[model samples]
Target chain A: MKMAWKEIKKSKAKFIILGSIVFLVSLLTFIISGLANGLSMDNAALIKDMPAGQFYMDENAKETYNLSKIDEDTEKHVHKEYPDAAAFSIQMGFVVDGNDDQHSVSFVTSTESDLFENVNDGEIILDRSMQEDGIQVGDKLTNNQYSGEFTVKGFVDQKKYSHTPVAFISMDNYKEMYRTNHMQLLFIPGQDKAETINGLEAFSNTAFLDTIPSYSAEQMSLNMIIWFLVIISGMLFAIFFYMMNVQKIGLYGILKAIGVKTRTLFGMMWSQMLLITAIALVLSVSFSHLFNRVAPDGMPFDLGLETTLQLSGLFIVIGFIGATLSGIQIKRVEPLQAIQQGEM
Target chain B: MTAFTVENVKKTFTNGEIEEQVLNGVNLALKEGEITALVGASGSGKSTLLTIAAGLQHASAGQVMFQGKNLTNMKQEEIRKVRAQDFGFVFQASHLVPFLTVEEQLLLMLDVSEKRMHKQEKKKRITSMLQLVEMEHRKDAYPSSLSGGEKQRVAIARAIIHEPKLLFADEPTASLDSKRSQDVMELIRELTKTLHITTLMVTHDEEMLPYADRIITMKDGLIV
Candidate 1:
């Protein structure tokens, strides 16, 4: 281990170059992963904000939340059985401001419960993002479907569905606008396992999120990019270490001839690898967290501490595997052959 | 006393379908505290025999007896332990670790030999070894900063720092000038006598023969 540290100290330029490349790759990975996570949040913060629970939808809807409508009787039965249960509906529609400018919103309504923002009739609590568009409290917003006006009650943070801001309206307003008395989904919070209802199918939170039309496809592509970056960084370690070991074969051979244990050689290589990776990860994690704070308002980027730690752990493991794979050459080195090859 | 003995040692190399026999039924014994030199042409298998005797490679069909133990019968780990604790080697090139300073090279050797001396004692030994090699002035110098002869001097110091029972020198002076080569040979002779260390060395230079107590000339893998 002392020899390893001495080598790195002696060859500062070489190791620094390796460290810089690792830093760049890992930083890029962190940034892209943050963007993917942020986009995911933007796409489904409405459902994601809910606690872990079971959602029951009509069996005839066939895994499509939009097409599902829980019968009135089943909704009542679930509420009676699970007193904390709530029935909610989401419909994508447009609201025209006083200037007749149309803004797309997911109109959401729920039965009386603490899980949702229960608004008064003809009043709407919109996502705070609508405030940036000049829609203010006490302003009258109109919907063409019901020939009625909605007064803005207040603004809530981070409530979105299908990439659109949410407008929480009363159940009477939702029923009047859509001409429907039945809610689309019945949610029972904090259930370990979803109890089977006769006419309804049960979905866990994750399953219900996947039922959103574009959620999986959108996340799959971003996740692919993030993993590809991670794997590329791993291969980079393998290639870099392979090259370094190849150059030092003669030195390794000479060391072995002098009775240095092969395990000591491996320990040297591993210490160097861990040191380089740890430095790189530290820099990348710091920069990515800083980016999370300073990114443009329009950029969807959300890097958190937990995700950063998980990714850094993966980097260390992958770097170890890569470096160890390259170190197989060290095990194969013969002292006689190195001697025959001349000075290192 | 015979400190080390090799009996009918052989080594063969296989290149594709062709086999080349390098050493054929060679035998030798090294006396304690004496330098025995093996002189031969490039293809005479002297280097192969030296490597085999040093436990750098295995003998195909022979026994290498050191302190009454047959090295050829030992496992790889057992052989490595013997090589670490009982043997020292100096090659044609200096072969000092480039990253290590002169004093550090000797310290590394002590570590490899697993010398469980106190830190102060180890440092004292390293300092004394540096003075013996006349490298104390450049104890902090890396290999890149040292001249060829100086590097070989440090390499020699590294070899003998652990005070092994046997020393193997494979063309240890081949990389030095005439003056430096004589200096290195003198160092080897002085160390072997003062430490009572047995030495087996391979050389092609007839000028260097006088430093050895006995000379074995090989023509075709057989000592004459």
Candidate 2:
């Protein structure tokens, strides 16, 4: 083992070249994995963290809660059963501020003094991202479709959902703007029997989030990108490692001729690859963190420990497979060829 | 006792549809403490015969017995082990592993042996062998940094470091000047006698013939 390590150290140049390639592939894999997780979180962060146990939707609602509607009478019936039901109206739309800068918004409606009364009357609570639009607390904005001005009350930390920033307002204001008294969703706290309440369909919060339009499509698209990166990176690593093994065929022959067993030679080759890959992974992850730290706002780069560990594990598996494929050529090299040459 | 015996060994090569016989019914025996010289022209089967005796190449027919162990019938792995433990080789080109230093090349031979020696013992053996070949001064130098003569000396040291019973040299002095060649042959002969190691050296240089106890000359793959 010591001799094998020494030999690897002596061939530092080749190891460096191989290590650099693996590092680049690992870095790309890490970034892609993070993006995939981040995209999913970005799509469902606000809803996932919302303080709701179950949601009530109309039976006619397709897969999306936005298209679902329950009248005030149905809402009253649900609250009668659950008693902790919070009726809210939600819609996807764009809002223009006093400076005419347009920002996508997910408009939610409830009472100014009840369920969401923390939101002031005739005022909308915007996402923190709206700060980029130069909107202040006293500024007024109008919905593109509703054509009514609303005051900006304050900002919250959570960003967009389905690419739209959330705006909280009173149920009366939301009904007046959309010209409807029906609520899009009823947020109920605690586990309650979700039986048919006045012919309205009630579902768990998990099920409700899945029904959001474009959820599956968004997730699938991001997952495809990540999967493609992993496959391509694995293939590239296998090819590079295989070619490096081919180049070292003569060295293997020499070692065999000198009475080194095939298993020991294999151990040497595997050790070389493992050393290179482990170092590459460490370097790439460190560099990725550096990139994240120096990146400007809204760069869409998110690195988490879970994603990093998962990617590292993936690279190690690929490295082993690649190294095995490369070392397969060892059996074909005859020891005689090392002495006489010209024989493969 | 005979260290190696080759009986009617034959080897042939096929280039496209044309067949060429490289070794034709060659028979030879090397005894325990004798230095035998294999002299022949370039196309003669001297190196081929040495390769067969070393068990590095298989004879197409007939038998090669190293201490009565038939190499022709042995498996490749078995042959490799025998060669590693019982036989040593010196090539025409001083083929030292380029990456290893002089001391490392010698230690590598000891490392591959099935009989495990302690680190201190192995180190002492390597140091003494390097001193024997007068290469202790350059023990840390890589092959690429050494002169042709120096590299050949290192190769000789690597071969004998394990103290094998038989050593085969193929034109060991092929790359050296006349004086260096003489010095190398003398060193090989002196070591063979002192260690009581059987040696078979192939060479086209008749000038080095005086150092050999016996000379077997060949032409057109036939011993003359």
Candidate 3:
């Protein structure tokens, strides 16, 4: 360990270059991960925030939220069985504020329940994001399909769907706008096993999120980019260490001749790997979180602590594997060959 | 006293369909506090015999006895332990770790040998070793900054820092000019007598042979 540290101290430029690459790669990974997570929330915060449970829709709709429609009797039957169940409907539509400007929103309505916002007739509750666009409480809004103007009741935090701010309307208003007397889905929170209701298909919370339009595809592409960055960084890390080891082959052999155990040499490399990786991770994590803080509020970038920890753990494991792979050359080195190589 | 002996050591290298015998039944012994030089032509297997005796490589059929233990019968780990604790080596080209300072090189040698010295004693010993090698002034300098002779001096200092029982010098002066060669040879001879460490050296410089206590010449892997 002391030998490894001495090498690094004596050769700072090489190690700094390595550390910078790790920092850049890890920083990019964290940023991309944050964007993926933030976009996921932006696409379906309304559903993601809900407790774990099952969602039921029409079995014939074939795993689509918009096409799925639960009949009134089905909703009644589900509510009868689980009094805490919430029946909800969602449709993407536009609302005109007092300024006469049109804004797209995921119009939502739900039965009386604590899980969602329920407004009185002719009143609307919107995601707080809409408040930034000049919509305010008591402002009257209009939808082209509805006959009455909606008085904006209030706003809730992080209520979004399909990358649009959610606008919660009354069941009567939803019925009048979409001409739907029955809710589109039935949600029963906190149930480990979904009840077998006839004509209804059950979906876990995660499976239901996939049914959201463009949710899985968008997340899949972004997640693919994140994984690619991780893999590329791991390979780059291994190549860098491999190059370093190649240059030190003679030194390693001479050390072996002098009775330095191969394991000690490996420990040296590992300590260097750990020290460099640890320093880079700390900086990148700090910078990524700092970027989160200073970024524009409208930007979809949410780097959660849990996600950061998981990715950090992955980087360490990959770094270990990479460095160990390169250290194999050290074990194969022959001291006699090094002596013949002349001048380390 | 015969501190180490090699009996009928033979080594062969095999190609796809050919085998070349390098050391053919070589017999040798190194006396305590004596410097034995092996002089030979190129490909004469002097270095091979030296490496075999040093336990840096294995002989296909032979016994290498060191202090009552047969190195040929020992496992690699056991041989490594013996090398670390009882043997020191100086190669042809100094072979100092490029990134370590002269002082750090010696300290690392002590660490590798697992010497049980207090921190203060280790430091004092390093200081004295540097003085003995005439490298006290360059103790903080890295190998890159040192001249060829200075680097060899530091290498010698590192090899003896742990005070091993035997020292192997394979062309220790091969990279130096005549002046530096004589100076290094003189230092090795003086230290061998002072420390009472057995020495095994391989060289081709006839002018440098006078420093050895005894010289054995080899023509075809057999000493005459």
Predicted structure with the largest TM-score when compared to the true one: 3
Q: Rank the candidates by TM-score, best first.
A: 3, 1, 2
Q: What does DockQ come to for candidate 1?
A: 0.75
lDDT of each: 0.91, 0.78, 0.91
Pairs clashing in candidate 2?
A110-A171, A112-A117
Quality of candidate 2's docking, in CAPRI categories?
acceptable
Candidates' chain B TM-scores in the order shown: 0.98, 0.96, 0.98
For model 1, residues A128-238, the per-residue Cα lDDT tens digits are: 989999999999999998667999999999898888899999999999999988899999999979998988899999999999989999999989988998898889888
Q: Model 1 over residues B21-92: C-alpha lDDT tens digits?
A: 998989899999989999999899898899999888898899899999998998878888888888988999
Give the poorly placed runs of model 2, Cα more than 4 Å off: A1-14, A47-65, A68-90, A94-103, A108-159, A167-247, A342-344, B15-21, B219-224
Docking quality category of candidate 1 according to DockQ thresholds: medium
Angstrom error of the Cα, residue A317, model 1: value is 0.5
Candidate 1's C-alpha lDDT? 0.91
How does residue A16 of candidate 1 score in lDDT?
97
- Write one digit per residue (lDDT tens) for candidate 3, span A151-249: 999999999899999999889989999987888899999998988999999999999999988999999999999889888878877898899999999
TM-score of each: 0.97, 0.79, 0.98
Q: After superposition, how far is residue A313 of candidate 3 from its true place, in Å?
A: 1.4
* Model 2 global lDDT (CA atoms, 0 to 1): 0.78
Q: Give the TM-score (vs. native) of candidate 3.
A: 0.98
